[model samples]
Every structure is written in structure tokens, then in C-alpha cells.
Target: MLGNVADVAQKEAVAALQKALQSGDVEGAGKAWQQVINSISDKVKTDCEMYNTNQKVLAQRGYRMLTTEETEFYQKLVKAEKESNARQAFTDLITTNGGMPETIIEDVYRELTEEHPLLNKITFQNVKYLTRWILNDHTKQSAAWGNINDEIKQQITSGFKEIEVTLYKLSAYAVIPQDMLDLGPTYLDNYIRTILKEALYVALEKAIICGSGKNEPIGLNRDIHEGVDFNSSTGYPEKTPIKVTSFMPKEYGPVVAKLATTESGRLRTFDEVLLICNQIDYLTKIMPATTVMTAAGTYAKDLFPFPTEVVRSNEVKTGQAILCLPEEYFMGIGGNKDGNIEKDDSTKFIEDARVYKIKMHGNGRPWDNTVAIVLDISALDPAYFVVRNDADVLTA
Candidate 1:
């Protein structure tokens, strides 16, 4: 799948350049040519910088250098492994420390954002045990604020309420070969990160979109309020999809108006927005609908009436799409809890390897129901670039 291809932007631009050159539109071909050059330049610069980042170095010290106290903490861990069986000693250290160290949690988060485009766009926090904050109840509003009366004072407090964000047990497990564990903290650290991030990239992406709130994060596509459309199989809430036939600006403006405000009808800054769809839908539905030729004549990918950025998540079903401000989604997956790793009794492992279960505490959801809009885009119009017979100008 092109969605799974590496160096995506560069590859896509190169493809577009080839298509543009074939179209015989000199102006569009030139723009596509420029885009190809730019994409390659950026890709090389990014790839070069990443080459210097050694996983072993990061696994030992951390992405952000460990604090003196934390460094000493590891030094003591090294001291604790005086026994010949370093693997057993390390296991004991993990048990004593809750589960995995906070460093691994932080590392996995960094990897998630770096590797996953969906994660990179949203608001993520490494919150503590419990982080309580105030969320204004957009359903309620204060009375007239000009006069300070008893009614006004009483009404003021109704507009907001406090919510406590706490962690829940999101369980996962990883298997490491005995040799790797014997290599001590560095190898274990790297393996733990690999398994954790791979697990989370799929799990979190699915949960953030359609997860039922039963022992998991409430999804952005699900209703925030209680007693909504419930799916018994998965315990997921189903949002009513807005029906739309085309994404052209003339037809697009009003369909997205509902998304340009707070639940309380307050206006929002719309510099950029996120659009998510499954890989199949993106290639067949969204790309045809959103890709438009520019004044320069080169085709643009995923351009919408409002500025948009596209991120693919197979979690989103085919024929459906999600629109929202990326920053409006809130997610926090903190390992700074009473965490621990234990043997998976259910798994019968061979003598060469051992599988361990790791429990992490984390929570995530949209800021509110209004932030995300699910759309029925099965009938979306395909874009076409046409030159007017009378006017010399081209249009998409």
C-alpha cells in the first residue's frame, strides 16, 4: 500500500511529477517538478539527521539526558546485579520499581510521535498519577455578566466543572529471547520500546477513533455524553455520519460549518484541520475528491475548503472520514504509575525465551463531542481539471 510506503511525500511527489509531465500542461509539470525537488531535499536532510541518533545510546541515557538522580538510580541498578544471573537480577529490579521505568514510557511516546503521523498531530501529555483540570461545560452558560447579582454568581459556576484524569490498566506483553535479557538493561530497553511502540501504534490509533469506553479510552468518533447509540458487541458509541456528495468549495463550506465552533457555538481558529480515513477509502474516495490542480497546473493532494492535513488510519472504516482540529484531542499515556512486569502464566514459552506481561496506566479522548465530525463520503465527487474553451485559464 502507498500508505505503508516509506519516504511517502517524496515518492508521491515523484509520481505526481510523472503524471503532470504526461498531461502536457507545461505550467503544471513545472510546479510538480519543483515539488519533487523540494520533497527530495527535505527527505535527505531529515534522513541524515536521524542517522546520528543511535538506539543503543538513547536506550542507555535516554532521548533527553537522564537527570543526575536518575543516572545514579541506574548505577544502583547496575550494582544490584552482582549475581551471576543478570537476567534474574534485572527482573527483580523491574518488580521492585512497579514495572518498567518512566524512561521507557517517555521513550515509547517519543517514538510514537516520530513514527506515527496520527499521533504527531494530536495533543499528548505525559501526565502524573492523577492530573485534575477544569473543563467548561459547554452545555451550560452563565447568565448576564454585566450585573453581579446572586443569580449571576450562581450561574457563573455552572459554566464549568472539574474533571480528574486518572490512569487505567492498559495491558500488553512482550517476548524477549534469553540472550537479549542477559545483555542487561540496554538490550531489554530497546526490545521493550520496539514491542511497546508497535503494539501502541495500532492499539492507540484504533482506540482514539472507535474504541468503546469499556476499560479503554472513549473514542473521538463516539459520543461523549452518556446514553448515546451503543454497540453491544464492542460497547462503542456510533456517531451519525453527515451525508455529503462533494468536497468542492461551493459544496464544502456549509457542511464543515458545524465543525468550526465549540460545542457552545464559540468560534475556533481554523489554520489547519485533520482528516482521517482508511487506506482503501483514501485512495479511492478521498484522493479523488480532495486532490485538485492548482493555478500552476500541478495537482495537490488532500486539499480541502479549509486547510487540511490527511492522516491514514485503517481503524476508520471504508466510505467514512473524520474531520477535526488535531489539537482538540487529548491523550495521556503515563507509565509513572505503580506499574509492574510479570510472567504470562497463560503462555507456555520454550526454554530459549520468556514472555512477560506489562501493565501501563493511561487515558485519552477528544476534548468533547463537537470536536470530531464523522462523514459519509461514499458518494463524494471526483475532481477534474478542465480548461474553459472561451477563457484561457484552467480550473479544478
Candidate 2:
């Protein structure tokens, strides 16, 4: 009767711990106490029993039950509870930091919604359920599927894997409204872009690394041992290299000659190129222009539609302070059949060719103290090519 009473009391303690840990709205060490208790109940007794059994079986091998080890493991629960309190404190600090409350919320939204097109299809209820699961930081591996779709479940599983890393980088400052209070966009453009770009890169890298046959426990001889190799078989020759030449007046030879060497053994993809270009441009925005810029697009014109170069000669030489020329003067050297600069004939094709004659008026020049003259110069077929237009800027 006494043993049964002890067992009943122990079970009650375990249940209480589990219930406390599983509470929906406990703060600080209160929530952690439950987790610590539950952990102790689940593993400590089992480990103790196992240790005791092993000691009995291996008495000749100097095996002895270490009550101290079990006690130490139990003590870790206390440490874990303390850590939980630390987390709550950190969360409180974020709240009191005088920045954005929605920073974390927006981060959660971006992580859950952006990049994954599935977010568009999933219902709000399922999303909330998933969000709640995320908040709980629990797994459904032991549970039933419930009503969530297989696709959404798969996404949620995958997304959950990265939650730790995502949370580490996503700061509360991102969601804070710097300008208008509570009237700004839900997510900042910079933050959204940052998350999307990182997520996209991660997905791409994972796809490349975890491709078929690579996941075998013992990696044997297989194709794609290295990522650089692409099959040139089946009548597909290697893509031709792109050559870019700088614009030069017949007298002073071109100073720049740029080329993107096919990364040997690397199968080039349109999407990969596009991503590289976007990343390069984003970095370039923060840096000064160098003599030869390594960018993603085909030509200078592609980087900045209708690029131009100017000549400045001192009065002692030509007596002209500056000679301004429209960007059109410097033609895209290696023009495709349709006059548009080629961006890999292998994947994306360029067809339409229309010339724009933009005027430039600037300071300390033949055209001094002025702005650029925007002009659409030339008559050409616009059917084949898509014009890159800036809606904010005026066009002729």
C-alpha cells in the first residue's frame, strides 16, 4: 500500500509538471518549471532504471549505479528553468527597447508567408494553427495529421527546421515604425527582401547539395560527385561565352573587356544567373563604381539601360571643360540579332531593339549645371523585346 501510494504520488507529480509545462500563457520561470519537471519525469526515472539494470548485469565489469549522475541530470532541469527565465527576460527587454513590437511579429509573418507560395493557398485557420505550433516550438511527429494538407504540413515541417536560425537574425528593431506611428506597411521592404533573399539562397543551396543519391548513408561512386560537372551529352554543346567591350571613340582604344567564363563543370541555370545578378546589384548599390564591375546582367546597357560615357578636357588642351554625350553613343558592343544586348542565348533570348536618345545637362561641362535629357530616340520593332521602364522617371 505504501509503494502504491508512492507510485501514485510520483505520477501526480509527473502530470502536474507536464501540465505546467504545456500551459498556453505562462511567463518566465513559471513556464520553464513545467518543462523541467516534465523532462525529469520522462527521462530521469527511465535513465535511473536503465542505469540500475546495467549495473546489475555488469557487476563483474566494475559497473556501478551512480546516483550522483541521476541527481546531476535532475539538477540540469533547474538550469533549464533558469534559462527559460532568461529567455522571458530577453523578450521583455525587446518589448521595452522602445522600437517595434511588430518587429518580431513581422519577422514571423515573413518567415511563415513570404517565399512559400503555399501561404497563399493555406487557410487562415491552418496558418494560425501552424503559428501556434511554431510558438510552442513543439513537433507533431508523434501526433495525427489532423486537417492540415500534406503540402502545408510538409512546408511547415521544413520551415520549422529553420526557425531557430531565422529567429536569431530577425530583430525587433526591424518592425519598429520609424516614420509614421502604426500607419506604416506591415512589413518593411528591406526586411522582407532580406528574408526572401536569404530563404531563396538557402533553398537553392539545399536543392543543389541534397540532390538525388547524395543522401545515401555511405556515399559511393555516383554522378555529380562535384557540383561543377554538367552532362554535355545528348547533342547539347557548351554555351558560348559572353564578350563585353567598352565603348571607345575610334582613337582611344576600349579600356574594358569583360567575360563570364563558364564555371567549368558547373551546369549554368537561368535562375542561378538571375539570382547572382540581383545579389550583385544589391551589393553594388552600397559601393562606389569600380573600373570593371562584375555584375549579373549581360552588358552595361542591361545593368543601366542606355549607358553613356563623358569626356572632360581641361581648357589648356581643348579649352572645353566637359563634353557630354548621351549613353546611346556608347553602343552595346556585342549586340544580339534584334539589337538588344544578349543575356545568354542558351536560356533567355533577347529580341527587340529600340534606341533611346537621352540628353544630358550637368555641371562643369559643355552642358553645365544641368540634368539629364530623357529621350526615346529611334524607330524600331518593340514586339520582340520587353522595355525596362522606370515608372517614377519621366519617359519621352
Candidate 3:
């Protein structure tokens, strides 16, 4: 399957370069040159993997393998082929871009992103794995509906609300010495991948907690306004903030079980619920064993409900945890409708570098309050999805 993809990519890249040259379009030719190099690099990696697998299988079947001299010769052949391709790609790029290193760099950056006409590895594409996502065509007002009920001639009562969709711009850059371009495609590929990964991680971390209406995603912690209170013994006012107190593992089970019950008198199931907490809390408290005994066992690890996921960030406090249905979190990415890479090279005059910027537009918020249950460590017996002054036991 991968071999077929590589073949098609190689053919298309050659055709694109030829067409650009015939039209006397140097920028387009540079882009085509980069595409050819990228495609061949992918193919070479795939071929290397296949070669290793075949060699292993042949040895397992008691077949005679190539001698050390023959093996080294084959490896050298592969290296030469890759280097030959890289040299051609760089030569073509320099010729098309008038031998201006800066111009060639800009074209390479553009091709690596939106202009490549393939799956982009430079952006935060993995956000889809963490939240329910929708692609919006433009920045505009949108709407999401809530659950509806059926009754005899009953009219709908506020079943939907308006949601403003906004886009956030995230940008980062890496400075590469001009001498590094001569090191071949492998070095360039690794350099680009490293910078892009760093940029994506920054965007993802902010998306997880940035407040809404500030040109950022409405994060999970920001959307949750209520939680179980643990201040009954202190007699603090209802809306007053409380300090966290540690609890034993045996006490974790009962408190977690009580969280499954909703105010609607429905027993919320824990089949799809996930406990999100910091790594420190999970290692030192949540998963630890306790001395308390019950019908099932004496350890809290045996009784705690649902699987746990650690978010390696300080946003989740040391003694706090969140119980949530991940499906209820909605994240929508917009912009880049024309699939074009935006670039800025003004920094070259001052810092001898080019800044490649990709504008990412997205917003996120909870689909429903009930699906997000915030649990304060001080108050474990009760959990809250909605803040209520009268229900002081569950409001924090």
C-alpha cells in the first residue's frame, strides 16, 4: 500500500515541476522540487523497513543470508540513491529560485505545510483525538442544540442556544544556519519536524484550558463552574473558596461512587467516564492501597471507578481531579479554507531568518454541563455539574 502511494507521489511531483518550468514560474518550480524530495524521503523510509523485515523472516526460515560484505554493499547502494535524489532536489530548487537561499527556504516552508496537497504533519492534527471536532468554513456565529423531549402537543422550550465561533492564531519559528541546508534531505526533514512538534504542543496546551470569548478555546476547567463542597465542617459561606485536605485511599471509593448519582435521580454509569488528574496525584494518592475493608476488597485501587488519564500540566492542581465524559467536549477548527500557507520573511534583514506562520482558527467548549463533573478534593462525597446556592453541599 505504501509503495503505491510513493509511486503516485513521485509521478505527480515530476509533472508539477515540468509544468511550472514550461510556464516560467520560478516559485512554483521551487515548490515542486520540495515535493519531489519529500515524497522520495517517505518512500525510502518505507523501503528500508520492508528490507529489514524480509531479512529477519529469511533468517528465521533457516535460509542463507547475504554475507557482511554483501550487506554493506546493499546499504551503501540505498544511501547513494537517497543522496542522489537529495542533490537533484536541491539543485533544481536553487536554479528555480535564482540561487537565493532565503527564497528557497520560504518555498520549502510553504510546501511543507498547506501547499503540499497531502496530509499535513506540521499542524496540530491530533486535536481531533482529544475532543469532538467540527470544521467550520469561516469565522461566524454558530448554534448547538440540547436534548429535546416528546410530549402530547408540547412545544419546544428553549432547546437550542447561540454559540460564537472564534479563531486563535498560533505561530512559532526555528532559525537554521545557512550551512545546514547542504547536509541533505534527512537533516532538513528532522529539523522541520522538531520545530513543528514544539509549536503544536504549545497550541494544544492552551486549547485545553484557555477561557472563552478571548480569542481562545473555552477550556474544560473554565467551563466548569460548580463542584462538590468540602466545607461543611468549617461552616464557610456557600461560594467561598476552600483549601484542599488529603484523604486515604479507602475513602476514595465511597466518594467516587457518590459522584455517579445525579440530581435528576438518575444513577450515572461509570462505563465511559474518565478521571483526569495530575501525574503527581495519581501516583501518590489515587492509585495507592488503603486499609479500609469492604465486601469486595480492602484496597481503594480495587474500588475506584473508571480509567484514569494524566494531563502533564500544572493547570490541574495537585489535590484536584475531574470526572468527565470526554465526548461532551466540543472543539471546532476553522480558517485555511483555501488551503494556503502564509509566510513572512521580514525577519531576514534583522536576524538572517525567515518566519513561517500558519494561521489556525478554532474554538472549544462543553456540549452540556451535566457531562462535566468537577470534584474538589476537600469535598469528595458530592460532585457538581451546575452551581446552585441552595445546594451548598455540592457547590464549591
Give the top-scoring candidate (TM-score): 1
lDDT of 2: 0.24
What is the TM-score of candidate 3? 0.44
Error of 1 at 2 (Å): 22
**Deviating ranges (above 4 Å) for candidate 3:** 1-162, 179-190, 210-213, 224-270, 289-303, 306-312, 337-352, 378-396
Candidate 1: tens digits of C-alpha lDDT, residues 1-396: 321233577557555654454455778855665455445434333433453356564433233445554455455455544457655665666666555566657778887898789989877886766666566645545456465543534445465657776566766555544455344344334445555665566567877887677777777788765446656576666688998888777777776777777766666657777889988888988888777666566776777777778898767877899987778778876654345455542353455555567667778877777788899988887765542433453432
Model 1: residues with Cα > 4 Å off, grouped in runs: 1-91, 97-99, 131-133, 138-159, 164-166, 182-185, 226-236, 294-297, 334-337, 344-351, 387-396
Residue 289 of model 3 has an lDDT of: 23
lDDT of 3 by residue, 1-396 (tens): 876787689668756765564466889976875575456546545554554457564334222344454334334322533464643443343344223222222333343444321112213232411233443212233344555663445344443445444456555434443333443343334344434433443344434533333555554554333353324233211222222333334544554564465433345565544555555665655544212333343333323333443333334556666655555566454433322123344564375433334344455655533444555654333221222344454563
Compared to the true structure, candidate 2 yields what TM-score? 0.15
Colliding pairs, model 2: 228-265, 228-266, 229-265, 308-327, 352-385, 359-373, 361-370, 362-369, 363-369
lDDT of each: 0.65, 0.24, 0.44
Q: Which is the better candidate, 1 or 2, if ranked by lDDT? A: 1
What's the CA error at residue 229 for candidate 1, in Å? 6.3
- Top-down lDDT ranking: 1, 3, 2
The RMSD of every model to the true structure, in order and in angstroms, is: 11.3, 31.9, 18.1
Location of the lowest summed lDDT over 10 successive residues in candidate 3: 117-126
